[model samples]
Structures are given as structure tokens and as C-alpha cells.
Target: MILREQLITQGVSEKLLDDVEKFKAFYALTDQNLTSRVPQTETVFYGKDIWAMCISALLEEENILLSGPKATGKNVLADNICELFGRPQWNTSFHVNTDSASLIGTDTFIDNEVKLRRGSVYECAIHGGFGVFDEINMAKNDALVVLHSALDYRKIIDVPGYEKIGLHEATRFIGTMNYEYAGTKELNEALVSRFMTIDIPQIKEETLMVILKNNFADANEEMLSQFAGVFLDLQAKSRNSEISTKSVDLRGIIGSLKTIRRGLKPMLAVDMGVIGKSFDQYEKEIVLDVIRTRIRESWEAEDIFPER
Candidate 1:
């Protein structure tokens, strides 16, 4: 509901909002057990244009792929979309080991009888939940081949040796992949063709401020700006090839701010959240310099958060 209002503040149209409401109403979840799967987000995705585009695509029943560098808020937006539509989310984290059995289903013995153990995608399709495929490119093409029928015009999952199931009308699959992450590879043409790809851009400082305000309301505005600057400076360095995007992390900044709220020193909190991400000593030094330049070595929690 907060994201709906924020979307309005960001100039997303009333029509799109109305459509999302209608979507929620039409595909209402009756499974009480799935209530917990509907995510409650700590942060919101802030781009009105991106929001509108995603709303439009989902309205037309298109599966979308969010393609971008790290920290572009792919998972955040996917989570927000699930929240907006009031859909339960089933998050499938792809890795080298991800395969058909892990995604669809596998058989297991219970009570001396072999029964099908439902997988995330299987459950997601049957319940009309939003399925978020994270780092999809990391999985082998053959592994994801099981999803072809489910994602295409057929809209069905045909499990071998079991009954084929139709995807619930409200079901939408959202895939996200980073541009340059370890153990990731190109998505094969067949897999890529199924998605309406949305290229996510880097977060702007203004948007970053709004996110910070949303998550850390007690934090001072100047301190929030400084935190935002830390990310942006790292982003600038990344763009110029001075450093990899590994240290230019939005989540790290948010986590650092959270640790600061818990009375950790600014530099140490950033060290854990941002600087520690890069294992390379040279990279860590660069990240440290970028962060220390924005936030002094001696800044305290009181400097960032005001009295409650």
C-alpha cells in the first residue's frame, strides 16, 4: 500500500494503479497458507517509468526479464510488483546446480511410498504466485529447458509421468540477471526469447535518498545524502572502470545504515557491508577510500540518526 502511494507520488498513472487493483481482486488468493509468501518489503523500487512499464507488461500477461548490473534493484522491483499485485512470491535462486527436479518437482519416499515433492515453480504455477528467477543465467540451458512450455503461449507445465497443470491466470514469472557476476553466463536464445526484457539502469542519487528515507526515517537528511553519495561515488568509479561494481552496492549501503542505527561506527559498518565484499586487498582499499571520502573515519551513530 505504501508503494502504491509512493508510485502515485512518483507520477505513475491512476489507470495503472487501478489495473493492479483489479488484478488483485480478480485473482484473489484463497489459499490461506500462502499468505506468508506475499512479501512485505523493507524498501521500494523508485522509478516511476520502470514501474509503469512493468505494470503494463504484467497487465498484458507478459513474462519480464530484468537485466542490469548489480545494485540496480532487480529483486527489489520484483518483490515490489508482488506486493503491489498482492500475489504470493516464489523465489527460485538459480545456480550451477539448479535443474529440472529442483524447479519443477522430484519424487521422495514418505511412509514407504514414493510421492511427488512439489517444487517452487510447480507450486507457483498452481497457485498463481509470482515466480522470481534470480540469476537465471547461471543455470545450464538444458536445466531451464523444462520451463519452456510454462513460459510460452501454452502456459502449462507438463511434468513427466504426472498430470500436466495449467498456470494460474495470475501467475507471472520475473527473471533477473546481472551483467557481470561470477559464475554467470549468457542466456541461450530460446530462453531469452520468452521474456520481455527490461534493462534496469543504475539508481540516481535522488531515488537513493527516497529509498533511504523510507527505510531509515529517523536518520538525518544530511547523513542520508552522505550515504547516497557513497554509493554514487562508487558507481562513478565503476562506470569509469576504476573499480568493479562489486563494491558499489545499494544493499550494502542500506545494511551499513542499519548497523549504524544499532550503534556501530560508520566506517566499521561500511567495512562489513561495502568494503568487505571485495576480497582483493587492492579492491578493498579502493572501496575504503571511496567510503571514507564521504563518511569520515570518526563519525558516530548520533551523527546519522537523530534522537527518537
Candidate 2:
């Protein structure tokens, strides 16, 4: 992999390249060096603009927080940024139980003596990797207080019992959250001020179709288009408040198409792909009717077996 400086020279943003270089140098002296960078992420045409903007901010003095509903590709985008910058990714999936001790390293007993074992965030920061805070809003706000100083202008981390360390110039945190969903809280102002928030809206039908066309080379184009229509129908229902589900993920539809192409019963594919995982029972029943009606009418013409 080329160094961050090389990537910049190759027409990538100077700011982003510099951040990558900083990460490499910072991690080189730490025990948690990833030893390599992320592979070049295949960028989706639909997200290029947003991705570039986010990368530019990350390179300068800002972090990014991606806000969206489920399946909006938040995590995927974060991973892609790390790849584009040739930086290793350190993913930390946040949950209610996550604590500062979990974000930074903790002292634990080893050989009857205390030894420091680095947490996901700390190790990644020291090693110059991108730290992806997945589903960050699910974590208790108090747990993230430790990150305030690290993320802001201070740009340093103080580990009281161990050492006060400064952040690696390359280290940046990209947090992902689904704020519209239940149980998610407002990102605290203190934390919010530190990041450049990018609101990830529902993906376009054309973009989703492109993803399916590219991902499944053998998939029939007609079927792919039909699937995209089905996804939009579901999304429309959600927006109109006629459905309780928040979104119909294009990736799920693609997976369903793959299953059907592999000879799984189409209804069974819809059941696993579109149903059984979202909304409450009444709403789910409504969605099931929609899926069955659409798949049966559209695919049965292709001799795809209908649901019993």
C-alpha cells in the first residue's frame, strides 16, 4: 500500500493524505501498530460527493458523525474512508454497556502484576488507524466523556493511571448513528460540536439498482429493476406513515435476489430478506402482503415459483 503522502500525490486530497501520514507515524511507535493499511475501498458512484466532503473535513481539524436510519450504509462509508486514505480501521461497536475503560486501555493482572491492555479506540489512535464508532448513540453518554478532550481542539488523551498521551495526527473518529429510531438519544452538544455531521438519507433507487447490477453479475437486469421498485415502495410507505418500518435496505433486497437466483423459493427469500426482521407484528403483516404481491406478480412471469 502507498503511504498517505503518496495517496495525496496521486490526486487524493492533501488534507486527507496528511492525516493518514500522521496516523502512520503515531502508530509506528505504539505497541498496537496494525502493520498495514486498509485496501482501497471500491467507491459507490452515488456516495462519491458525500464521501469526499467527509474525508476533507477529517483531514483538516474535524471528525465526522454519520446520522441515518438503519441500513443507510453508515458503517460501510466509514470503512470506505479508511480504505481510501490507506489507513487501518479499528471498529468499536458501541452499546449500553460500553465504558471509558472499554474505549481506552485498562490495567489488568498479568503474571500476578498489573499490565495495560489497550482498548479499541486507544490502540487505534496510537497506531494511526481510523476508529469507527458504530451505533455510537446506543452507548451511554457518560461513557464517552473520556473522548471529549481527544476529539476537540485539545487533541490529546490523558490516561490518569497510565500516561497522558497526545493523539496521533492520523487518528480520527467516525461515529455512526440511527437517530430516528427509538432508544437513540441526541448526540450531546459537547460531542456534537466536535464532529461534522453528515445526514445520510435513504439511498436512491437508481443507486440501489446499480449496486445490485454490479454485485450480482448473473442477476437478470429486469429482476433487479423490479427489486428496486419494491424497495422504493416500502420506503414510500415508511415516509407516508402508512408503515411502521423506517426503511427497506437495498443490501437486503440484493441478498434476496441472490437467494432467488440460487434457486431458493422466492417467497422464502422475501420472508428472510424483507420480512421477519423489522417493525411490529401488524406492520410486518402489511409489509408481507406487499412483498408477496409484488414478488409473485413480477417474478412468477419469469417462471419463478410463487409463494404457497
Candidate 3:
């Protein structure tokens, strides 16, 4: 089944699903070409409660703010929400350099005439698309102030030197923030108040195993469990301040499994995906020790997956 159907089957209220479909049908009637803006995602968000909260917020026309640690599937849920609602998605990765000009439109000289170059936020607002503001706290408070009006009840964007534009009724913003990450600033109260915040919990062991099995169908249960154990171990260490979060990478584990499927040694594949991501020698050694404790040297592709 498609994502929308899956969401409904997964217990998203039928009423909410009807509303989303109506909105999508109305959007289609407008002739807005938003196919290119839709995000294609392979990952499925598994939490029923989280999905329910997100769907309810979007149905109520409230902006969503997902706060969590790394690998909690924030981006995945954001993408899934847009897919479920049949809305186009605009991903804006915020960093230290992000500013109001970057979120809104800017004037540029095109063919000797000043033309307005619309940014992701501007386009998403006007087209009634889902705007995913990733790592929002990474940007300075002043830079994020531009979103206040758009996120609030007003739903308006006052672009400098341009006509005041009201956001499309279907427009919604999903902001994600990792408060524990280094160099990320605390979100200002005003901005925080504008969003209906949800604290995303780390994926449970059962869910992680499911994700692994789904992604690496060729791998055996033993190897998948081992990888999940290693991931949880790293997460525990990171939580206790024994290690940096650099080693707690869900994507790295999946990438390593793929490499193993390609006939590379398990250790080498793990190193390339997990250990090699850290540049610091000490950090690498710490991660390598963690892996060594979980993965034995004698393991091979055949050991991890007998069918392979």
C-alpha cells in the first residue's frame, strides 16, 4: 500500500485522513505543479503515538516542532507526514549562516533587471507545501525571527521590498532540533511558543530490529540483533557522557550492512561506515573498541547471513 494508506491502517484517525485527502484534492484543483517538490522516502516512521500527535497537529493547522537526539527519525517522520498529507515538501537545513534573506526571497539582477529569487520558505508558503526546517536551533535567534509571523496564527510573510503575502491555508512548517548537539543554540522562547512541540523518543530495540530487517532482508536475525546491540550500546555511552554522539549513527550501521552484502569484510565495512565517520583519533579508537567488543574478527558475510 502507499504511504497514505499505510498511515490510515496504522491508526491515524479516519477523519484526519479524510481532511488531508480533501485538502489534497483542493490543492490539485489549483493547478499548482508540486510534484517536483514532493520528497521520496524509503524509511517508515513506526511510532503510532508520535504519528497520531503529528497528524492531529497538522490537521489543526499548527506548526510542529520535533525535539530529539540524533537518530530518532525526526526527518523521516517529517517526510512521512508530507507524504501522508499528499503535500509537496520543502527541506531547509538551517545552519549558523542561515538568515531571513535565505528563508524569504531576495532580489537579484537577472538580465539587468532586478528579479525576486524565492527561497524554500517562500515557495513552500505560497504553494501550501510542507516546509521542513531541519536543525532549526543551529541558526541564530535573529535569523529565525523571520519565521515568527509565518508560524503564528497570522500566517503571513512580510517580505522586505515585496508585497505582503498571506501563506496558503494548507501551508505547514515542521521544525526539528537536536538540543544536545554541540554548537546548537537554544531556541528562543518566542519561536518555541509558536510551535506545538513533540519530544521524539529514541527508537526502541524492537523497532530498530524491524527497521534493520526491513532494510537488510538478506541479513540473518543474529547479525541484525548484534548490530542493534552495538547501536544501543553507543547510545547508552553517549547518554552517560562516555562518548560523543558521532559514533551513534543509524545510517552508518545500514551502510555497513550494505557493504557487507557487497562482500567486503565485516570489520572493514563497519569501520568505513561507523568508525571512519569520526576524524579524531581518540574518538575513532573509542568507537573501534566498542565495535571490537560486539563484532568478532572471524565473522564474515557467510557468518552474518548464511543465505549470502
Clashing pairs in model 2, backbone N/Cα/C closer than 3 A: 23-170, 27-127
Residue pairs clashing, model 1: none
Error of 3 at 261 (Å): 1.5
Q: What RMSD value applies to candidate 1?
A: 2.0
Models sorted by TM-score, best on top: 1, 3, 2
Worst 10 residues of 3 by lDDT: 28-37
TM-score: the better of candidates 1 and 3: 1
Worst 10 residues of 2 by lDDT: 299-308
Instruction: Tell me the TM-score of each prediction against the true structure.
Output: 0.92, 0.82, 0.90
Report the Cα lDDT for residue 48, model 3. 76
Off by over 4 Å in 3: 8-15, 29-32, 109-115, 278-286
Instruction: Give a tens-digit lDDT track for model 1, residues 207-237.
Output: 7888888889899998889889989999899
Residue clash pairs of candidate 3: none
Model 2 lDDT per residue over 66-152, tens place: 987777778767876776566678888888899999999889999999987889888877776788999899888998999998898
Q: What's the TM for model 1?
A: 0.92
